[model samples]
Target: MMELRWLEAFVAVAEELHFGRAAERLHMAQSPLSQVIRKLEKNVGSPLFKRSTRTVELTAPGQALLPYAYRILRSLNNAMDAARSAEGVPTGRFTLGFSGMHNHDTLPRITRALRENFPGVDLNLVGGIRTFDGMRQVRNEDLDASFLGIIGDVGTPLRAREISRHHLGVVVPTDHPLAHRDAIPIHQLRGESFVMGPVDGNSSMTVAALQICHAAGFQPEIAQAVSDPFLIVSMVAAGVGITILPSEVLPILPEAATWIELEGDPVPFSHGVVWSDDNESEPLQAFLTILDSIFPEPTLQ
Candidate 1:
């Protein structure tokens, strides 16, 4: 029987594509990590990696086995967590990180559920961080999970499931020319200035707004880049510049500003939770169980 440690070695190598880095991540010497890969490949009767002095790539078999490997490991973790839960209430610590739209209906409800269900587990809610920071922290295990406003795939080693989707809208000063219109095409704002969140990967909103403008065939003239969504709206209200945002921020819009839908094909904007598959703490599992109850089904964007 193949040991679980071998699967761990396989996944680490497959993700990093560098035996040295993978071994460092696994805290094992490069020689033993290489031996484990060889052993796993032999048991499967195929080479898993095409290794070179500088480049390492997964073979076809390795590619095919990757998803199953993730599932097997996740299943084992879930099974273990279940067994532990049967003994008594779970007691441990879980830290959750979030960026943008912290007041979204889904997030508050999830936190409330966690407090109610796992009172024995200490919960730490960290907010105001950016999406990229949250992703990095979750992968590094500094946080058990992160709620993010992501523009694209969450990528490998980490997984994300959508919490909710939002429609794109334009926030303009009540006195602006476009304010009277119920909706605005992105192209109309080509020469207009925009207020957006910081571009330092902290704000997925900035990326989403830029992408919308790019699709409309122009680069936005950014007037300001601030971190707070509320502040972004306030800037627009004070005539700093108009801005694009997800509809979820509508409630916070002051009377000085109005939100108009983007008059075009819907752009995909999603809020989701991100976590590493390698974190198997019972507290995390319990928290995830609450999340699963809320999301119920996987959302594919």
Candidate 2:
């Protein structure tokens, strides 16, 4: 049977690319490390490393196994941590995820609430590259909760509570022709060069921005597609192209960029707190309660 220790040894050797360093890292003798690798190879019926007097390189098989080994190790660590956390009397330790776009505004208040109300809880905020992936983590119990934009698609097994809404707006260069306009009509931006975010499944902002352009009767000519909002704003500042972003982004706009509210019934973006139905942790519940108190649902007239 392939042992976990052997896999660990192989991974260390593969990463360090030196038996001596790998052995030192594992706090073991080089001979035992070499033996472990041999055993692993025998078990798999294939050599994993190409070793010489001065160099130790991964074989094709080793290269292929590297990603699986790392993933397994990460999963094992997460499982052990989760087990240890659950075994102890649940005092507090909340892990939250957030989309990078929403974190600037929501993180401070969330952290403040956790500090004031659930002082015992260790608040860990993780930034995610994509909203859907972050939502998946929340649903999978990897994250206790997350704040993400309201994705019309890619439904999850978690419940979401709407917290805030922001209007869509255009970010243009300060000296641009439309800079002084109170509100820019979407039609006027047709065929205009744009700096946008991921237009695929990852970002709702990108999808909505494109939809607005298409509705205005012409597809936007994209100059760049960047994932980071700050980078998108910076690109616009550099006169790359105009960008459509949430109004919340106005406060963080670069000095060279000016924000203009989009005229007509522009699509508003919403961000919300999400958590798994199966996550019954007291800290998570307490955190949710704090969120409810801080940002209560608005009563419509």
Candidate 3:
């Protein structure tokens, strides 16, 4: 029978597309990795990869095997997690994803409440590329849940529980002319050298900012592309550029920058907790209950 270890080696290699790099990722030697791949191919009666000195490509069988391998491994891990939860030890670990955009006002309260109520649960928090990435991960059973800002059409697939809303705000340097305004019109930002995050993938902030800019009648002349929203303040303070973000980010504003409310509700940001339709974990259910206690009128979809 083909062993799980052989599948693990194959998956690692397939993902990395290089035996040496895959070996390093697995913290094993190339010799052993090669041995395992060969053993797997021999056991399956076919070569899973076509390798040259420069590149590694998956064979048809390899392509067919990857998804099943991932699903099997995930199922095994889930079974183990379930077994641990059922051991009568009264201790469990629940992993949830978090984007930096979550509300500071409620998360601490939520965490504290969870700790106080479920003393046995170790609330595992993982950071993500974006909130929507968490939704994808949840669907894959990689996470139990996540807290993130939902944007247009991105959170449609996952079951979203609305936690809070944060209207868009303009983040600018203290000395910038717009800093003096109570709020600024979107089109007034035309021709400004804006700092933007990547809109590719599930980056809602970037998508919303660009959409707002387009509505305002021009594409922003981007000065810098930053990944983290918190870092945008420093860039703005350094006179590199300005950015638009959610009102929830106000607490993190440095002395060099301040926020002005946007002129209209162009595109507002909503904080939501997302999970897969398949998730029915106890810890996740407990979390939903605590969330209900905190925000009673929570909207679910």
How much lDDT does each candidate structure score? 0.84, 0.79, 0.79
lDDT of 1 by residue, 5-97 (tens): 999999999999999999999999999999999999999999999988889999999999887887787667656665767777876667898
What C-alpha lDDT, on a 0 to 100 scale, does residue 95 get in candidate 1? Answer: 87
| Candidate 3 lDDT over residue span 125-230, tens digit each | 7864476677778776668788877764544346888787767878989989888899889889988888877757577778878888887789998899877766
User: Candidate 1, which segments miss by more than 4 Å at Cα?
Assistant: 1-86, 100-102, 296-301
Best by lDDT: 1
> Residue 229 error for model 1, in Å?
1.7
Ranking by lDDT: 1, 2, 3
Every model's TM-score: 0.69, 0.70, 0.79
Q: Model 1, clash count?
A: 0
Tens digits of per-residue lDDT, candidate 2, 121-150, equal 678877754667667777656688888777
**Cα RMSD for predicted model 2:** 5.3
Total clashes in model 2, counting residue pairs 3 or more apart in sequence or in different chains: 0
Q: By TM-score, how accurate is candidate 2? A: 0.70
* Candidate 3 pairs with clashing backbones: none
* Shift in Å, residue 288, candidate 3: 3.5
**Which structure among the candidates has the greatest TM-score?**
3
- lDDT computed for candidate 3: 0.79
